[model samples]
Target: MSTMPTLDTPVTLTISPDGGIDGRSRRYEKFLGDMAGVYRDAEAWQAAVSARGADELVYWVDDHRYQEGPGALIVGTSTLLPGRIGDEFAVTRGHLHAIADRAELYHCLSGHGVMLLETVDGQSMAVELTPGKAVNVPGHWIHRSVNVGDEPFVTLFCYAADAGQDYALIADAGGMKSLVVADGDGWMLTPNPDHTGYRKA
Candidate 1:
């Protein structure tokens, strides 16, 4: 068997101006109109978002063993585009931990946004995010983040190495029941009708 890398030296990770963790970083992009029915005005939003070319970006560390399970620690940053999807703002593709009891932690390093969380049993909530803010995601909840400001939303995340993300669970549920969007001078929290409950803006 191969030995693990020696820890005799400091392992340095660079954060790009946009909050990307350098060195073999992987990026996933989502255009503004990506999530079709997740918004109130689907067709209108799709046309508007597409015309603006707004896109969200998720940057992940290039370590190959993250999905291997057990002791692996996965960390990365998601830079949500500074725009809206109908009444919703730019957001990450949320996911539930493949290992049900695996929790995750997220630190907001830059920008303004909120972390939307929900459990399979119907509990839902949101945590506002600003520079230096951090939030914990319980193992039983599926979560995602939204950029509700005029600038890019960036946040760093850490989770158990063995905890894999189940994106289909979130997609199948039609996304979180609530959304964060720009509200004139600040931001607004609104409801996503696709999900069961309604949250007023």
Candidate 2:
């Protein structure tokens, strides 16, 4: 079973006004309360990162089980380093397992890239993404992104589902396969019986 990260504990703060406080002082007190809330939220986010570790941004769960089952929200951000000359990652055609929920969304935080998206029925499309652009991956659709520019690719990923459920799972086409490695010469692709084909970059 995959070890899931624990949710951050909540923090609460309360402020009481004094009977003799002036209007400006009251306003300042309110501002302090607001700042406290912001600090609490940031602390919670940091705790989550500490529990999950920084590597979750790039760790690929190649061939793993969805221990949380289905329908859970998993929010994360990821950054991909620049590929060496002639380096490539071949992506296989597959569908996300969480079909009952809304589609997964990816917002590009920086860099330039293209994502190949295909329907379960074989229709294909490509989306060009740059900084500040967002793309929604329809549930059960086959999609993969490739960095086509010189810089490292960065993105904010949001997967929505019920608590304690798997955020996403890849369903491979009949025979399609993919390889992600540092060496450019190690990748290859093949045709799948389910009407999808894989290619190496």
Candidate 3:
């Protein structure tokens, strides 16, 4: 069910290439310590925490949601710092929308990245993104961002305001089916051996 805003006023936002959302309503951040079982290389992750300290910021998001109804939209930005845990790249703790069938758009603003997308029923894809490139992610697909460059990978994103995230989907499934990994000086998509398949939400 959708509800119209009581005050139907227009809102403007300034999105920066470095992942800043000037009119964002909220800011969320994740540190190395926040990722416990997110990485396949557990030992490598642990060693990284020991070496770089667990408080190191890995990624963050800034978003603006002006209304609360299903008809409303949330515009946001994601900034992911570059690093590697074994062959795996730095990633956002991915999710499927809580509504399950809500689509989203991600446009690269800076640096390089890969949109790792997978379906609950074994379908998968890895799409590389650079400045000016975007991916229209269809509904029912779980998605995560991977930073494979030396600089911060930033993106501008927009989706239905009512489409909330279910972040535990990937963790519960033992991670996504495909991983965006290092391949020489470039990147590649490889199967995640530990994935036990998604448990439909």
Candidate 4:
């Protein structure tokens, strides 16, 4: 009988702070049109689609997934281009890990941003990150990346390989519990009126 394949060998990854890895297994891109219904300002998003063209690149992720199972890890970089839609800044689609209890770590590679976090139980937090800063996001939290600066918000992230993202959770709840908006020269978190609270899976 044929033998099962052996496990993967350890490898060195040359990661770039600007959002890339030398041995990335895949790259995913999100365009302006792909973000419909994500921002609270519907009118602004529509106007942006008209002015910038629907296919404009909004963000991209490069990741390396070497294995699968309980102990495997997925490493990657997220690059979010800076922009504004109404009073809100550019943000990732956001998600809750499918496993629910899987945690994550994000290290700021460049630019200024915020890690917007919220829990199903009404807990909310916004942690600002500059180059060299990092956030260890605990499990059970809904998280997203917000770009609050003029440069691309880039971050290096790693999480359990089995921690698949539930992208529809936020959409089902009518958006997250808070919105990150401009506060003069800074940024602030305001309640999202449309949020209907999270529904347990």
Candidate 5:
């Protein structure tokens, strides 16, 4: 548990009408889809990308990358774009911590979604989230979130900055071994064939 700092100089965060974090945020427009580079579906994927706009804004990362000694903490909120990649919902580019023993925490601020977690040791899980919910991400887990609601999904996070992220691992693996998708009125989990070489749970 970390305490809020008593600052001589007050730092402020402002949220725009569209949920953007003022001054301290980055946006990603080229988010890879699950079908990206699937040779068989290249045409379909290309059409979708063209129709939807290839550089559609995927997510907004707002953070105060503050260092407190050798150990540091990052406070931020990720606002996920609302839409689907084929049948799958839009998701964050997930990552595993470079420092395998480090953990992270997330608190849902608004909208609805699911958080996916996996480990090198063959463990995997998905937790649903909504406003006001908090989740503790244990060490050694690779994690990401998917927006399942109609509106933009947003969540606040606090994590060890020392636990640098290794995104290449997940990208090289073609993303998580499972995915959450729209199933009728709700959503369901489905295995990602691209990740067949990896274990799920």
Candidate 6:
């Protein structure tokens, strides 16, 4: 009599022992096709970005991730235009809103500037910032900066997070808007509105 297979010793067989190998291999081929499609899409995206010069020479740095949860993303742009002896630019200032996962940090790569930090209890202080210097803006603190130099100033800014996240909500705050600058006309605040090249010129 023929013996039946038991759980400890089961028989291994294919869908069809004769010629079903091609069909089995087709599934793997489809998976490879899907992966190739993803790679093509990524390559196309990089090409388009390169054509527009959107990611040109720029100082960009940020934390890898937050210790507790999500992290933060910080981005800054600087230009070296012709400037007089006392020309100043108010970059940004005011209440540091709490991010979901990360904190913010700033590193002054070039030029001279000042970071005015105010605590929740109404105490404020100005910290001098220079190239190669780094500052950590704690969660929920208010801060701002001013360029106090004669030449073109450059800065590198960054953000940290409890998790890997981007914290840009402060860009939408009311009092936090504008950079109060020490121009020839004394302290002047300018609206920090998002500008497009087509709209301005």
Ranking by lDDT: 4, 3, 5, 1, 2, 6
lDDT of 1 by residue, 1-201 (tens): 999974433346676536676753365556554665555567866687567654633222323223445666667776776766566676777878888789988888888888988888777888999998999988888788877777777887878877777877765656576777668777777777676532221
Query: TM-scores, in order shown?
Result: 0.79, 0.45, 0.96, 0.96, 0.81, 0.40
Q: Which candidate is the best by lDDT?
A: 4
lDDT of 2 by residue, 1-201 (tens): 899877644333221111111111111111111211111133643454466453433212111112233544445444444432223332222334334334767777777655656554445666777887989886645556555556656555556533222212332233323323233433323223343342211
Model 6, clash count? 16
Residue 68 Cα positional deviation in candidate 5, in Å, after optimal superposition:
6.7
lDDT of 4 at 35: 96
Better of 5 and 6 by lDDT: 5
**Residue-by-residue lDDT tens digits, candidate 5, 1-201:** 999876434457775434556656354343544336431234656777788666666777777663443456777778887777667787777877777778899888888989989887667789999987878999888898889999888888878878888876775676677878789978998887777443332
- What TM-score, to 2 decimals, does candidate 1 have? 0.79
Extract clashing residue pairs from model 2: 71-162
Q: Once superposed on the true structure, which residue ranges of model 1 sit more than 4 Å away at CA?
A: 1-10, 53-67, 196-201
**Local distance difference test, each candidate:** 0.69, 0.42, 0.93, 0.95, 0.73, 0.40
lDDT over C-alpha atoms for residue 83 of model 3: 95
Ranking by TM-score: 4, 3, 5, 1, 2, 6
Off by over 4 Å in 6: 1-89, 93-95, 98-101, 161-201
Model 6: which ten-residue window has the lowest total lDDT? 28-37
Candidate 6 local lDDT, 16-42, one digit each (tens):
211122112122111111211111133
lDDT tens digits, residues 80-184, model 4? 999999999999999999999999999999999999999989999999999999999999999999999999999999999999999999999999999999999
lDDT (Cα) of model 1:
0.69
Per-residue lDDT of 185 in model 2: 31
Q: Give the TM-score comparing model 3 with the true structure, all chains together.
A: 0.96
